[model samples]
Target: MAILIPFGLKMQAQNNTSGNKILVVYFSHTKNTKEIATQIQQLTGADLFELVPSRDYTTDYQALIEQAKKEINADYKPPLKNNLQGIDQYDVIFVGSPNWWNTFAPPVATFLTSHDFSGKTIVPFITHEGSRMGRSEADMKKLCPKATFLKGLPIRGSSVKEAKPLVERWLREIGVMK
Candidate 1:
């Protein structure tokens, strides 16, 4: 079962072997992305923060797609309902988002741009139908030029509920778990 860890809550991880403070920030329109975020926390003991827009996106799939497409075409970054503080304290950030319009959701753009990730590391995790990472990784690099990125994880949205093992393996492969 996916843990319903509240967004923005800081939970001390049990196995922070790297000794670097870590945070998981994500934008989940559906719960698929959130489920992956929860798994990352369970594996690495990272804190969780949800990215919420000041205005929620429409629930209708077609409407949301059109909305996302327009936002991406314009390179828009919507205002977030909440933003993290003391961002400089975290050494690594696991950024999660649904692959929307071939990119990370707009709120993710705001979150990445709003912080100074210079000298920091970003571990990207994306959920998608079939687009996979699409242009999201490329766009993320543009958003945070100074941040170092590990290889990203792209899970099929339908497979998320069965993904704990995959998630654990990914953490080990990335050297986040050793």
Candidate 2:
């Protein structure tokens, strides 16, 4: 079951076990992270929560780069359009983001800080152009100190559609999927 939240954010229900309540939360600018999040959801039967920014980023490549650099340098966390509810019910969270300036996007940082994930297991995944994983895992670990961090999967942005096998393998390796 998928619930359509305000601002076009969709949350999908997990139809698996009740013990391991899973949530896949992500911030996707170019849809690469979104694609990976969808694959993870399929494999684990997890819920989906998309982080939509209140302010939309520019579509121009150079402009987007400049904006990202400015935000990262300032350590800015843009406001999210919709806030997620019932986050405490999840035990495992899969966080995905595009690699921006060797780190996760600013909006992902916002989402992390907004929620309290004291005892949840966090599995990170990144879609990068060339800088694989970048500093995303480290950054996330810093933000979510109390959560258990798993080995992250980094896929090239251009090859996201072909990433099902890799994503499945990582899920199995992490013991999220059998």
Q: Cα RMSDs of all predictions? A: 3.2, 3.8
Task: Give the runs in model 2 whose Cα sits over 4 Å from its true position.
Answer: 1-18
Q: Residue 173 lDDT in model 2?
A: 84
lDDT by residue for model 2 (60-171), tens: 9999999999999999999988888899988999899999999999999999999898999999999998999998999999999999998999999999999999998888
Candidate 1: regions farther than 4 A off: 1-13
The weakest ten consecutive residues by lDDT in model 2 span 1-10
How many residue pairs clash in model 1? 0
- The digit string of per-residue lDDT tens for model 1 on 19-53 reads 78888999999989999998898778787888989
> Would you give me the overall lDDT of model 1?
0.87
**Global local distance difference test of model 2:** 0.86
